[model samples]
Target: MILLIPAYEPDDRLIALVTSIRTAAPDVHILIVDDGSGGAYGAVFDGARGLGATVIGHQANRGKGAALKSGFRHAGRTHPGEAIVCADCDGQHDVDDILRVADRVRTARTSMVLGARQFSGRVPVRSRFGNAVTRLLVRLATRLSLQDTQTGLRGYPASMVAWLQTVDGDRFEYELNLLLHATGAGYAVEEVEIATIYLEGNASSHFRPVADSVRIYAPLLRFLLSSLGAFVVDTAALLVLVALTGALLPAVVGARVLSSTVNFLVNRTLVFARGTDKPVRTAAAQYWLLAGVLLAANYGLLLVLTQLGLGLLPAKVLTEAALWVTGYQVQRRFVFAPPRASAVERPVAEPSRALGADVR
Candidate 1:
């Protein structure tokens, strides 16, 4: 097992943590990436090395995701098929919890094990508030109920390292992207509850709440933009057609056809194309099926809202707001899902010694 930590401007807490882990599990290989912490923090990295860890240094600070990828590349070349668990260096993760996650990875080698934290009493307000909002948005965006959407401690099997290395994100958003795309790449996320520790209101955390939040929610934002564009097109067509034809059925049909086509093209070409590889016909079919259902549901909801004393414009807005998240979830999970891996990529027929067991 390899314990990979990414540290920047760290203090004795990092050194103490390394020492304690080495004392408890002497055989475990510790790899710490000094993310350009500079000369002042050299003593801490030196102390970690003195305790028998291999410290890799970069001249300039890269983000946590980059540091992790650096460690992963090193592990892939040196340790090859070994299990690796990542933990934060700011003392939030207990060594025992790290070991537990490692053990789970050893058994469930095909799964990505997450050391999820339970934010109960005495949690920092920022931590609590950030997690709560993120969790809700993640659920709406992906239809996945994750207990901890932003936990840094996670375990990855050797088989997943190649795919993990390809996942984009230089900062905190990278972790969220991994979780969001894990299922599409045929990996399941298993969450193991861990203790939540915050030091001095989480001041040690380098996350810029506003900036990082935008990056983390970038996918949802793009989807919203696409949907808004489609809505505008659809509304304009509907009003024009209604005025010209004086028939609701023809107006709705024309508007839906034009709007859905625009939406499909935009989403296929821009929003989801980066992460998805499903064939156009397959995706289009699923998209139209969802659009048909949503079209009916949307019109019905608008009518219902209007009947309940809301104005027509207000009702339309309320109805769109209600279905916006549902639209994103369906389009992401069903329409743009990647195809299953080929036999060579799957290798499910034979037992994978590299992954340890058939946790699938």
Candidate 2:
């Protein structure tokens, strides 16, 4: 098995991360994908090489997605049969977990194995919220119940390695794009809970929360924009329900039930279009499950907020905002993914020009 590290000017931290992998899994070949780190970081590669890692250098910074594509391509040609696991250059990932996850990938030799961080602690506030939103988008897009959709620590079987090279998203958001595309190609995603070390308060990340959040959720945002009418229906339902039942949980549930169904119907018919490689029966089940989990979480939050010295109306608003993030995370990760059909013979709906995202 080959361990793939996509690095751009890897500092001492990456050198240590690579070193730890060397210590933990000596049998696994390490591939450092250097994206133009300049002369200053050349020593890091030399050190990694000394510690038993093959360095593939990119002349310029081509972004994380591009680096991974290049690295996977290199692994395909060079290692050929060994499985590849992609790990961040940042030291946040646990080497032991990588070993464990990679072992499963090596043994099963099929599914994509993801390192899922325990979000209860260590995760930054912005990171938590953004991931929650993206996770839902992935659920809706791919109909895969993923615990941590944005986690960069992932293992891939060698058979499907080449397809990842053509997919889009060169930045951190590429993780989202990879997952969506993987599901579309009918690959199964497996989660492995990993220990996360957020050094220096997690401030070193390259992802621009708001801008990248838009990009990460690009595919699903388009779907939601197309479903704007459903948003209005949901808000209207909420207002009418509160007026009728004094903002009780049942009323909130009733409102969300009606509104979410409207959104679901629009997504199923419009965004998903029943023609992708995804199995309709399983996808539909995952869709309802995603909505049910979000609805429960939304209403539960409202109940807690209302009981904690706040007005029901404001509580509803706060909880709804929370749900919006949560719902997007679950739906996008599991629901709206591309299908496994080798080729889409007939697109059920023309790609909506109005809902397209500016990836650049």
Candidate 3:
């Protein structure tokens, strides 16, 4: 098993973590990527190296995603078929938990194992709130209920190294992107509960709440903005068409056609299918089919709401809110999903002693 840690401006805790791992799991190869921690952290990296861990260097901070990829590439070249487990360098991850995740990777060899934190006990306010929001967004986006979307303790089989390297995002967003696309890429995610440790109220965390939050939630935010833009176009066109034609059906149809077209274009090029090789024509066909169904549902809901003593604008608002989640799910799972690779078949193994009940 290979244990990969990505460190940037680390402290003595890093050294202590390395020493503990060396003592607990001596055979596990430790690989650390110094993500441009510079000379100030040289002693820390040296200590890790002196403890028999190989250290990789990056000239400047390229973000956690880049550091992990560097470690993955190096592990592929050096360890070849060994299962890899990634843990944070700040000592939040227990050595026993690390070994547990490592064991799962070795046993499963086809699933992505996550060292999920319980988030119980005294957790930081930002950390708790951030995880909750991200967890909800991930569930909404992928229909996969993950307990911890932001955990750095993850395990991947050797077969997944190439695919992991292909995942996008250079920073914190990279981990979320991986979870979003993992099922589509034919990998199952299994979670193992680990202790949640917040040292000094997580002050050592380099995460910038505002900047990194935008990047992490960029996909969902883009879709939301696209929907809002289309809503404006749809509502305006609907009102104008109603005044011009005095027919609700024609007005709704015309408005939806214009708005859906705009929404489709933006979502395809910028939001869901960006940088993908999936054919535009194929996606368009799927998208239009979905739009047609949504349009019918939209019209039906609008008519029902208006008949229930609601004003036209109020009905429109209510109708859109009702269908918003449905639209995102269908578009993400079917319309814009990438082509899946062949999945490996493996038997479900019983949970290890460190493993907990599965999160819904």
The TM-score values for the models, in the order shown, are: 0.83, 0.65, 0.87
lDDT of each: 0.81, 0.72, 0.85
Global lDDT for candidate 3?
0.85
Q: Cα-based RMSD of the predictions, in order?
A: 6.2, 9.5, 7.6
TM-score of 3: 0.87
Better of 1 and 2 by TM-score: 1
TM-score of predicted structure 2? 0.65
* lDDT top scorer: 3
Q: Residue 50 in candidate 2 has what lDDT?
A: 76
Per-residue CA lDDT of model 1 for 185-218, tens digit only, reads: 7788888999888888788988988998898888
Sort the candidates on TM-score, descending order: 3, 1, 2
Residue 169, candidate 1: Cα error in Å is 0.8
The ten-residue window of minimal lDDT in model 2 covers 351-360
Model 2: residues >4 Å from true position, as ranges?
A: 229-360
Error (Å) of candidate 2 at residue 125 is 0.8
lDDT by residue for model 2 (25-126), tens: 778888887776777777777888778778777666767887787777677767777789888887878888888889888865558899998787666778
